[model samples]
Target: MHNGFMRVTALALGIAGALAMGNAHASGFQIRENSVKNLGRANSGTAVAKHDASVVSNNPAAMVNFDRSAVQVDMTDINLDASFTGGGTTAIGTPLSGGNGGDPGSATLVPAISAVFPLSGAFDKVTVGVSVDAPFGLKTEYDPQWVGRYNAIKSDVKTVDLNLSSAIAVTDRFSIGAGLILQRADVTLTNAIDYGTAICTASVPGNLGASVANCLNPAYPFRPQANDGNVEVSGKDTSLGWRIGLQWKPTDHLTIGASHRSEIDHNLTGKADFTAPSAVAAVLGPRVADQSINAPLTTPSVSTISVEYDFNDAFRLMADYQATDWHSLQSVKIFTGGGGVLGNEPFQWKDTSFYSLGGEWDLSPAWTLRAGIAKDESPTNDTYRTPRLPDKNRKIFSLGATWNVSDAISVDAAYMRINVDDPTINGATSSSGSHLTGTFKAHADLFGVAAQFKF
Candidate 1:
């Protein structure tokens, strides 16, 4: 009775899904487009740089730098270009191998809004701010009839964050900030099923060897019917995390800041939606129905420290370091509400680090030019690379400018390009018969614009 009751209670979290794909913006799904100023600087100096209200996304302590109320609105357009080339391609158990998967990459638009205000009286040393942005997301879809259909059709994951933060100046040279973060996450992963392989494994276990091979090729008379249907797992969840930071300014020309953001554990609740041929459905039974699935995912935490130095106000140099605790995301495990195992994706991701250096040069009283470069370590290795997220080491180059319309109004525009080290997808997945071997070349272009209004 106790065991049955425990099973019932776990089901209350609902059934959901899990998805993984590469993010060109930052390590893992970390999106750093909160401000065009920071993006132009390759996301460096976010913890210490002062430009707009969007600084709340970095270190809340930076908010104290703004004496007047300011509102910042930003928009970023991303152009994704990725393609796979087949080389020694083969699916161990299925006869599905063809040309390149036809560029699964997709274009995306990310937006952010934030505001900061000062308080009077005893709260003169305090500044309050709020920010809303989509911090993580990307999507990739391949042709339904592609060679890797059984591996991936559509894989996407997205997260939106709402942060409310406040900063207080303890003294002239020191300040602190903290925030409450509320985030929502959604996941969708889809793939095709080889009908012949399922049936042979079920009915004719004795003669399964020759059946799958023959049925996979249409030219063979023993071939099973083509188009056996597809499977899509979808899930959604909400979670809470926290952020804290401190800023220290030893000299008027030098600024330093450190910040730590907590990880969010999400129990996504959704169901498995399957559509298979009649015979295949009968064999799979409840597995293909609206059965409950529960996928637990822990987004990684990050620690960042940044430094900015002003050289006579006309030229500024900035550097920063970021460490992501990706070790927590060791795997994507899914289960039924009744404690039945559904899927286990061994991500085995490792903690990674990022380093950046940049400088901003004042062209005139009204315009400033910014350029930066950064290098990111990959959390994943070649051993676990999959079609879902063929992540690898990358390098970034950025350039932008800030146009001050007046003292109270300014516009920031920037562009960045990312180059992903050519990576090979050669691994097995949760499915027994799924083995994918190929190479992917992926790159991205980012353009952003932000307007700041001070009151």
Candidate 2:
């Protein structure tokens, strides 16, 4: 029974991964970009001090620099593009229809919002603030004719976070801050394919192939593919997490910062829908409860550190490092309301780290220029990797500037380019020895703009 449950869960993740074809993982295909200022700096803030609302993610300690009560609002948009580089159809009883790679479907309209407002300063320069932000999200789609449809079609993940924080300047050169994180996340996984092509194969034992085709055909008693019958699962999870940070200005011209957030365990609540061929449903549906399956959500952890250097009068450098415990995502286990196993699957990910370095140059009294570079490692293993994510290590280049509209306001704009190294997966297989091997390339471009207000 435990093995059966595990298999069912694996199948569920496989389905989920398929729908989230371009980007989905233990972190749920989400980006860490939240504030316009950080985007301009390649998200590097481990060290320098800033008075912007972006302090919510950078270093809450930096918020101490803001004197008056202030509020800042920000919005960001992300665009992603991905394409399959190499992979051929499996002829060894492959359970997929159609040919190889197709058009690279695109996803857009990704929007994020965040706000910060400071309260009374009780301690030396102490300020309490509340912020809401989208810390992570993903959107990936593939052409209907892609041969990997059975493994993935379209996958989307979204997350909203609320943080209550406080920061104080302990000394002229030292500051500290902390935040209580409340998180809400949602995931949707979908896969659509021709039932006949998915389950029928001439090499199968007995007359199963003939039966599969006959039952799934449009003219037959069952028309599962008529509307491109799909399997879908949607769920939401809520979790509690926390972060602590410190900023030290050791010298008049240098600054340093560090921060950490603890992991949160989430109990997700959601539903699933499975549209199977009538003949197959008749045999499997009775054993399961319905045409659907449901379960709890997964939990993951993230940690980051950053630093900056202020040189001369208006020039500074930035660097950031982040680590995500993807290894904790080794498996996804779903639970029914009664504590029964609904589904579970292996994620088989390794702990991963990301590094970024950037610089901010004050081009003029009213204009600030930014540029940065970053490198991120992949967490997926070759054997377990599939078209859904087809992930690889990547590099990012970013540039931006803030125009001082007046003494009290500024507008920031940034552009970023992402490049993924081609990844290869060999010896992919089905339980029956069916094999798959391929190479994949992933990339995307993002343009961002945000306005900041100060009083």
Candidate 3:
């Protein structure tokens, strides 16, 4: 009984480790679809653009540029296609039997809203704003019996952020702003469990007197790939963070802006459920039963610097650079009810950077045209890459246009195409004794529209 309990404990730890592999539309699972106007230019000048109420989320300090109350609503559709071609896969020194998983990526819709209101009377120099957006989210589902099923079958994670901010124009040329961030995160992960390998690899004798020799016997009912179990883990958490921004207009044609958002930490508490073969369940007993679990996850912080240059009334140029503190996510630690450490999954992710250059041209009195290009770096390398997130460096191209329906209302539409560098997984091993080797072809497309109202 003691040995069986230990084996189950190890399996539970492995299940918890899966929580660390959430995919994202942006680098490192971060989402950048908060503003359609910005997306039109590949997010260039996001921190300095004061064209709409989205400034409330991009750079609160830019709110000072708004002379009246305004509201903006945006919707973005992201379509991702990722497929894996298996080079080879094995479990416990035996070749795994299964075909490559079909396309796991799916389409997702992201929405954002923001409002800014300027103060009256003595507070004339102050402006307040609010924004609601999904800062992170992604989902991937693979065929149940795929070659890499042991690594991951399904991964879904989502996060929402609410920001309340205020900006003060200290002087005509300088402005400062700060905001409070309320964020919520939810996750669900699933994977196959090799019950046969678990029993044979047991360091101590199993309750059923099962051993390596028994597993190797042709007549044995339970052996690698013969009897498979499944486990699913789900959790949710809410946390708080903060951000600050600065904007300076040194000259009439040039504006510079910078912002920093702090990291948010979450202590996710949830349940782990398992479905084991009848025979395996009988041997493991309560160890295979459902139990409460906890995991620690910290979203990374981000810093951005942007500049917008207005050469003349008809044309403007913009550039932006951003850095993500992905190193903060070095590892994910899982714990049981009594603060007992289950295991730690190491990611060793490095920090990443993003760069973009864009420009806008006034085509006519009622229309404007925009175009841009950008490059994003991936945080993971070949050693740590997994099928759940198979991220890689990517390039972005975007085109957009805005129609000025009237002085008080305007509509912005943008489209983006992302080209991802094919990533190769070279024998990445999992704690469950499964080694997956493959290559992935991936790409994404985004379409967005926004309406802005000023009152």
lDDT measured at residue 397 in model 2 versus the true structure, 0 to 100 = 86
Q: Candidate 2 on 1-455: residue-level lDDT in tens?
A: 11231123323332234333343211234466677677766677743447467677556777776776556666555555555644433323434445555534354544444344555535547777777876665666666656555455566666678888888788989989898989887777665534333333322223343444553455654222232345566667778888888888889877778877676666556665666556544533433243334544444466777777778778888888888766656667766555677655566878788888998888897899998888877777776776666677778888989898888888888887778777675644322122446676556676778877776
Between prediction 1 and prediction 3, the one with superior lDDT is: 3
List TM-score per model, in order.
Answer: 0.91, 0.84, 0.94
lDDT, candidate 3, 1-455, per-residue tens: 22222222222222223322233357878888998888889999998887778778778999999998999999998888777887444445778777778877767788999999999899999999999998776777888988988777887777889999999999999999999999988877777777777766553334457667766788877677777888777778899999999999999999999999998888887877888899888767776787777887888889999999999999999999999998877777767676766445666789999999999999997999999999999887888776766788989999999999998899999999888888787776654567888888888889999999999
For model 1, what is the C-alpha lDDT against the true structure?
A: 0.75
How many Å off is the CA of 71 in candidate 3?
1.2
Q: Report the candidate with higher TM-score, 2 versus 3.
A: 3
Clashing pairs in 1: 15-270, 15-293, 16-270, 16-293
lDDT of 1 by residue, 42-114 (tens): 8889898777687687899989889899999999887768888663322234445555667776677889999
| Candidate 3 TM-score versus the reference | 0.94
Point out where model 3 deviates above 4 Å: 1-24, 203-209
Score residue 163 of candidate 2 by CA lDDT.
83
What's the TM for model 1?
0.91
